[model samples]
Target: MLDPDLAFGEPVDDFSHCGTGECRVNTLPVLYRLNQVISESSGLADALRIILDIMRVSLRMDRGIITLYDRRSDTIFIHESFGLTDEERKRGIYAPGEGITGKVVESGQAIVVPRLSESADFLNRTGSPESERRAKAAFICVPIMLGKKVLGTIAGERVYRSRLLLKQDAEFIAAIALMIAPLAELYLIANVEKVALETENLRLRNELKERYQPANIIGNSKPMQEVYELIRKVSTSRATVLILGESGVGKELVAGAIHYSSAASEGPFVKFNCAAIPENLAESGLFGHEKGAFTGALAAHKGSFEQADGGTIFLDEVGELTLAVQAKLLRVLQERVIERVGGSRPLKVDVRIIAATNRDLAAMVERGEFREDLYYRLYVVPITVPPLRDRGSDVILLTDHFVAQSSRANHKSIKRISTPALNMLMAYHWPGNVRELENVIERAVILSDDDVIHGYNLPPSLQTSDETGTTFGVSLESKIHAVEYEMIVEALKSSNGNVGLAANELGLTRRMLGLRMERYGISYKTFRTGTPPRR
Candidate 1:
């Protein structure tokens, strides 16, 4: 007897010796074919197509159908079928316990009919054929059971004259259904995970696209405006760009702006830090290697150049590359091709190069440390990112941008910076540049207790001394006034003692400037060549 959860517990007398006949030979080969087909298939639809085709040819089963329960719609719909017209497949849907297929799925058991036409529960939903050949066939419907739950049903029809017994055929189909149950469940789960990952990837790409826009660089200073113009000019061509700047002055940010705003923005943007790789493996890291290229090389690998094909490759600290690697890189820049570490064939690539370095490549070339040929090739388009000190008032703009970012990230309620804190930030000489400014602001945001970022929350280095090496160790209010006084004095001198011009340059009204000057006992004429008479 079959298991109680799988079928009715009754044995037919005539079919008791059916397995001894042709059943064992035919059923064993069909199971082997099912395994072979399922292993080669990558999708559930293809696997089911092969499984049903094997049943039709080897077991003489036709009109095969597989239906899975749709939990969302609360119905069983045909997922795969063989020997059915297109119109018939479209009409194959049943609610639980509504028809023979639905009944099997609902009952968690099997149903077998010796003559499909004689069974009152058989609903021939498939379109009519010329010979009415399906009406005279025997039918078998089996629930695909796992433990106690019925996941789906598999059913098929065979002509009555076949040598296979109905009971033997029913058991064979049920065993195959049991084998396919786990595989179908796994396929469904994998598909869901793949969709989720794709959605997340698209979101990240959009974020990168927006973050690298020229308007998003956060500066209105003349130096920054020049950098923006250079970015626009260089983005129109495919020439190699060499970015010169101190460390942490946003060289990578400039690289991203060039790539995403260029014609090749739709293509990939691959980044590699030349200083991060080991000297011995630098060649393999830049140019991919074939399988068994070295001790641990088990498979073919694509290096940065190949990965960045049809796009741009940003090599940070390109000055650190050894002479041997530099010689190979020169070949790539000259011919747009690369040879794998262990392979003889040279593969052509269409990558645009954007290399950045803090060191002077000209000096390196003079010393013969860096190849002169590569230096000229990369120097075709050069853009220098100005350090933090050169961009006078951009520090306050950057500080506010970072404060807002850190507020949202850390879930703080910081809204504005106190005047004293802003004064200190503007006075410091940021050797580490914009990157360091962002770090300081993020730290201040985290440490700040009130909604406003006060002087006490800032780092000690920024607060103690000004860029001119002058120390203001007084109270916070007094230090703020001192920094204000110094800035006013410098502005007045630059304006040649014109109070109106000084006020406009300092982002202040003339009346406010005069009031502050009188309070600080500063006469505009002392530093200027000649003073304009008071209006």
Candidate 2:
């Protein structure tokens, strides 16, 4: 948490710029206080409140809410807010498909609307004045996830005539997600760990890791074949390369694939996400830092480049870099030399770069947001990981793989899925892709007492995929299967919907999933209801 703030600096004029240097300098004071709240705030509630407050002020919005994925309800709740009456805020519960925020949560993507009245994804559950929904300006909602699991979201709504949240805002928010993400994880992990300790006999932990390990990248489909082929081709290349794909598309897996199969296979394979690092220390992290480089620089430090000097440095989200750092990276790429921050000489390094990002750097470059030269540098040999929806049978193939893996790890005898569960997985939109599937399977593995996994154990998302967006689970059918739906249904039937113990029953892939009961019955309407079948 503190780390992201460290290298990222205070993000002076971070996302939205007013005028040139002068205007940005003036706005600094106000934004500084906002940053204080966002970065330095402690405790989950305080942090969330601070975030909403900051957004409300910075964006000049009438309302802002930070809804974290509530594990207890399997739904999203407006945990904190700015510019909303208590009466309305209290009614913040969002079923998977309830409204815009709900749908965005269900779809697990950011949505921007200049006018809600004209949008098809609008959900109006809060009972706010019609003007709140119809008012001019933009409403943007984005998923807040730490790697695979989605915690909740940060939504901003400007009052009538407010400017819309642009793609840049969404991208910036996406880049800065580290702020709320870890806290959400901390909250979820705390609950998980507590329950895990209580369910001493549960073997869900190992079950999850094994299923999501390098081996779980299952697929024989043409798209998968193409992925494998690209992985193979890139594996042999010494050229710097880039991997592009959405979250849960397994960019890291592809990173692993490239490393394990490379000539430098024996060499260390190190990974780092540029966006995850703080701006101030980003350079020192990627390169090295000499003693006294900064306040806490206590001693000399070797950065990632040096640590993996003889191997590969996988820069996940490489485009999150600042232009200054991009320039440094350019030098490293061209000269294979890196100078430690605060040091004089450039150290020679023999490392290959495999950059990855879901964002479009080329377009950013065109917009003068990203460096054109750096974009060209990273585009040397690009590899694409298609989303699960486009991968055909890869979903089933991967599902089968995870089920078996989970079964063995969990010490269960389950061999396969029942037709309904299989069909549900097949028919499901898989917005969260393989990662979501893995979580669902893990849940099902524990819930399944018989040889076959049943649909009843599936998460509400998978069980009702036809109705709403499943929120954060993978839409990429190409990765893992939904283990949550079956498990939740089974747990509910057994424990009678007692969320706590039910979640404790197992752990599977979709490693980032939390089975909050946000119904996916409708995204186009707030009048919809979430009706999960009773076990």
Error of 1 at 67 (Å): 28
In model 1, how large is the Cα lDDT of residue 151? 69
Candidate 1 segments exceeding 4 Å error:
1-198, 466-470, 473-535
Using TM-score as the measure, the top candidate is 1
lDDT of 1 by residue, 1-535 (tens): 2332322224433443345443546556656766776676655676577668656766668678987765444566666888886546645767788778878888888987766667798776554463566666767899877678676788888765432356666787788888777766665466545534543454455568679988899899999999999999989989899999999899999999999889887679999999999998888988999999998999999999999999999999999999999999999999999999899999999999999999999999999999999999999999999999999989988888899999999999897776546667777899999989999999999998768786657776776654524345557785676557666766786677889999999999999999999977778786575542221
Give me the displacement of residue 467 in model 1, in angstroms. 4.5
Relative to the true structure, candidate 1 reaches a TM of 0.55
Please list the C-alpha lDDT of all candidates, in the order they appear.
0.79, 0.68
Per-model TM-score, in order, reads: 0.55, 0.48
Per-residue lDDT of candidate 2, residues 1-535 (tens digit): 1112212112223333453221223434654554565566465666665565556555456777777665555567666777777646655666676777777667777776655666776665566787644455557788887777678888777632212224445555555455668767776666764533423322232333234334556777787788887777777789888899887878888787777667775567788889899999899999989999888999999999999989889999887899999999999888999999989987999998989998988889988888887888889988888888888888888888889889889999886676447667777777777887788888999988788877656776665444333323445441134444445455544545444554566553222223234431211121122233521
The numbered model that scores best in lDDT is 1
TM-score of 2: 0.48
Model 2 / residue 493 / CA error / Å: 22
Residue pairs in candidate 1 whose N, alpha carbon or C atoms collide under 3 angstroms: none
